[model samples]
Structure formats: structure tokens, C-alpha cells
Target: MSNPESFRELCRNELHSGPTSGLLSGYVQANLLILPQSAAESFEDLCFRNPVACPLLCKTNDSPYRLENHDRYIKNGHFDIRRDFPKYNIYHGGELIEQKNNCVDEWAEGHVGFLIGCSFSFEYALAQAGLAPKNVVQGSNVSMFVTTKYLDTSGIFHRCPYVVSMRPYKVNDIEQVRQITRLFKKTHGEPIDWGFDGAQRLGIRDLKQPEYGDPIDIAENEIPVFWACGVTPQLAVATVGQSIDGAVVGHTPGHMLVLDTTQVS
Candidate 1:
């Protein structure tokens, strides 16, 4: 996990198929979304309005995937949106069509790719602070749920509710968790909410079940802390896709694209 190229090669060879929470520490891991040009503009606006849930890192057309800023693009090199990630969720007319190893075949004409900030960036920071994220410790995907909270709608993305990822921390360490996460605003920022009654506030009644990711144990002295998740956009795409005749593609929960940026370090 120390080498980016090696991790990519593992995914390239289909040897990996799980959430990438603690791997390749210090490098950025992005939540990837690919939309048709028709839906791209509106989705971009939605991200702008909901920065905590969908921080925009880079947006580019499919085919030649590169960051928009030319100088930075040169250093980051070219990434093929279709094959670089470990897993992808393919949607058609808003329905989840399939989960695939890669989306190289689905990058049809007019498709655009967006790279969004992910909480993984801050996991590295948390690790450095010795506040080990629960998912990393358990070797599981961060638990994610669709909440009653609504995202600002733009264009076809209508009535999309926010999705959140939760982690457990000792009650005493809650303040430290907030302070460490606050530094990575581009990556969902600080805890949106926390505590024994936290899930109820978001309309999630059962902690054992989540819309995405896996469940973990909550210690007696621990409380649940949440962050605006990148999964929020996928929930939006599902809701909006039913009404519109289009599709949205995204990385499967916990499976993300690793970047070369030292932004977290």
C-alpha cells in the first residue's frame, strides 16, 4: 500500500476488491463520478452548492482524463477513468445496472468524469494524530447511510437527500476528531453530528443496517461521529435518474481512486 503504482497494479490485475481506507497513506483518494455531458453541468452546480458532501477536485471529459489546471495536470499525469479504479457502480435510467471491475466499456461518447474529495485524505491525518479511524482498524468500509437531510438540487438532480459516513470515537476524543478533520475542508471537513442519538437525527433508525458500507461495533465509551460523504452524490443520481432518461457512474462504496497529491500530508 505504500506505492501508488503497486496499488494501481493490484487493482489493474483484479487482485483487490474492498474499501481502500488505510492504504497508501498520505496520498489523496478520490470519490469518482462519471456523468453524461447532459447531466454534467447540473451535477457540477450541485457540488458547488454542497461542498461538504461533494467537494470538486477535478472535472474533465472522458477519454483523456487530466486535471483542468495545465501545470498541475503535467505533474499528475494521465489517468484513465474507466480502468484506474477498483470497482464502479453503473446506473442506467437511475437504476443500478451492475457493479463492475471497470467501466471502460461504458464510457460512451459525451461522458464526463469528475474527481471529488474523499474522507480518506483526512484518515491519514487522523492516523498521524493516533485517532485511528474505525474502518481502518476493523479493515472494513466506513458505514454509510442515506439521511433525511436534503441536498440542494440543480437541474435533473432533484430531491436528493444527503448520505453520511460514520465512525466511532471515544467520547473524550471527540474534540480531537473534530479539530483534525476541520483542516481538510475539501474532504468533507469536520464531523457533521455525533452521539448515541446521532443516527436518529438523520432519520436512520437502525445502526446495524446501512444503505452502503458495513457496520462496526460501538464501544460503551464511544460515540458515533459523522461526515458528509461522497456517497451523497450517488444517492442523488439514483433519485434523479428515475425521472430523467440518463445514467450516472460512480466508484462503489469504499472503493476509490488514489491520487498522487501530497495535499493530505
Candidate 2:
């Protein structure tokens, strides 16, 4: 994980894989979404409207055949959105068609790839603050839950419920954790809620059965803290994919794209 290019190469060849939670420390990571040009405007608007849930980093150029992070932001120009992530979810006609290690063969004209800010980008700062990100410490992906709360609908995307990533912290350290995360606004910023029954309020009934990622044990003195997730867009499209033709593409839960940019503050 010392070299971003080497890690990406492992992904490209399907050699190294998993939730990139703690790997490649001191670099920014992103959630990815790819859609047709016809659906780009609405999705972009959706991101702007729900900044906490979908902070946008960059979008691919008009050439849909390939989507790369903006070169200016990356130290190396060899990353490919389609093949760099550990896993990808493909949708069609409102249904999840399949998951793949690489989707380079699927890219076509009119497709636009989006790079969204991920809470993973702030985990390093959290760790430096002595508040170990539970998932990283546990060697598991951060647990994600689709909540009952709904995001503001924009254009063709409608009724998308908010998706949240959870981490447990000792009650006394929760406030300091929130302050550290708030400074990383471009990377999810702050905890939406924390404490006992907080997840229940967000409509999560069982903490053990998270919709995505692996679950961690909540210690006796720790509280479950929540953050807005970039996966919100996928949930939105799944609910109304018929309107957009059901051709959305994104990274599978917990498997994010690691980038060279370290800090945006």
C-alpha cells in the first residue's frame, strides 16, 4: 500500500482486493458512480443538494469509453475508475444484474463517472487523534445502514433514503471525534447522530445485520456514531431506476477507490 499505483495495479489484475478501509494511509479515498450523460445533470444536482451524503470530487470528461480521476489532482495518472476498485455493482432495468471485479468491457459512449467524497478519507485524521476508526482497528469494512430518513429529491432521482456508515466510540470521546470529523467537510464532515438508540431512530433495527460492510462489536462504554454515506445515490437510483433506464454503476459497499490527494482542507 506504499505506492498507490502498485495497489491499483493489484486491483486491475484482480490480485489484491477487499474493503480498502485502512490500507494506503494518508491518502484520500472516494466513492464512485458512473451513469449516462443523459442522467448526469440530475445526478450532479442531486449531489449538490445533499452535500453531506454526496460530496462530489470530480466527473469524467465526455469520453465515456474511459473514466479517470482528474490528472491535476493525482500524483500518478494511471488510475482507471472501472478497474481500480476491488468490486463494482452493475444495474439494469431497475435490478442489480451482477457484480464484477472489472467493468472496462462495459463502459460505453455517453457514460460519465463521478468521484464522490468518502468518510474513509477522514479516518486517518481520526486515528491520529487517538480515536481509532473501529472498522480499521477491527480489520473490517465500516458497517453501513440504509436509514428511514429520505434525501431531497432532485430531477429524476426520487425518494432515496440516506445511507450511513457507523463507528463505535467511548461516550467520553464522542464529542472530540465529532469536532475532528467536522473539519474534514469535503470528506463527510461530521457525525449525524451518536449514542444509544440513535441507529434505531434512523430506522436501523438490528446493528448486527447491516445492509453493507462488516459489523463491529459495540463495547459497553462506547456509543454508535453515524456519518452520511456516499452510497446514498445508489439507493436513490434503485428506487427509481426505471426512469433513468437502470444503467447505474458504482463501487460495491466498502470497496472504495483510493486516490493520491491526501488533504483537501
How do all models score by TM-score? 0.89, 0.89
Model 1 poorest ten-residue lDDT run:
69-78
How many steric clashes does model 2 contain?
0
Off by over 4 Å in 1: 9-19, 61-63, 70-77
- Tens-place lDDT per residue, model 2, 1-265, is 6677778888888986687877888778878888877788999999899888888888887763244446645575576778888998898866788899987876777788888888877888888988878788877778899999888888888888999988999888988998899988878899988776788789988888889878778888888999998778788878878877537788887788887778755
The residue-by-residue lDDT of candidate 1 on 112-154, one tens digit each, is 8888888888887898899988888777788888899888878
Best by lDDT: 2
Question: lDDT score, residue 9, model 2?
Answer: 83
Error of 1 at 120 (Å): 1.6
Q: Candidate 1: what lDDT?
A: 0.81
Supply candidate 1's per-residue lDDT for 127: 80
Worst 10 residues of 2 by lDDT: 64-73
